[model samples]
Target: MIVKMLHDAGLRSEHAYLGAAASIGLSLASWLASNRQENLERADRWGIFVGEWAPTFFGLGLALANYERTDGEQLIDSQ
Candidate 1:
């Protein structure tokens, strides 16, 4: 249902995968920024919080990929 909704909403697997990648980058950036501005504990918390999003995005990407494969939309191109 979520995959269908995402598809209907025009969100492809690549978008989720890109979001996952961006989340990782954001996690690092957040950690660095917090470390510089705040402290190690805050930085760790920020990193952990942002880092957790990657898996959810990756899971959504996988689900969308499977949906695309079964539905034959080819929304995400192999490259």
Candidate 2:
């Protein structure tokens, strides 16, 4: 199920790169916004947390998808 989700989201290098890039952008926005306001810590926290997760998710997606292709199946490396 997770593999299918990643595949449908275009987990190739191109998409992974995009996801990572987006994550950075979100993180920046989160940080900047967090520093600008005093009553929006939750929003800032949410954005920052989610943003941080994006890069890792995209990176894993890339590695798994590539592994799948190399193995001629959706078999990701266990390393």
Top-scoring candidate (TM-score): 1
Global lDDT of each candidate:
0.94, 0.70
Instruction: Give all TM-scores, in the order shown.
Output: 0.89, 0.53
Taking the tens digit of each residue's C-alpha lDDT, what string does model 2 give over 1-79?
A: 6655666666665666677788878787877777677457776776778688776867676776675677565345554
Q: What is the lDDT of residue 72 in candidate 2?
A: 61
- Candidate no. 2 TM-score: 0.53
Please list the residue runs of candidate 1 whose C-alpha ends up more than 4 Å from where it truly belongs after superposition: 73-79
Q: Name the candidate that leads on lDDT.
A: 1
lDDT of 1 at 61: 96
lDDT of 1 by residue, 1-79 (tens): 8789989999999999999999999999999999999989999999999999999999999999999887875544432
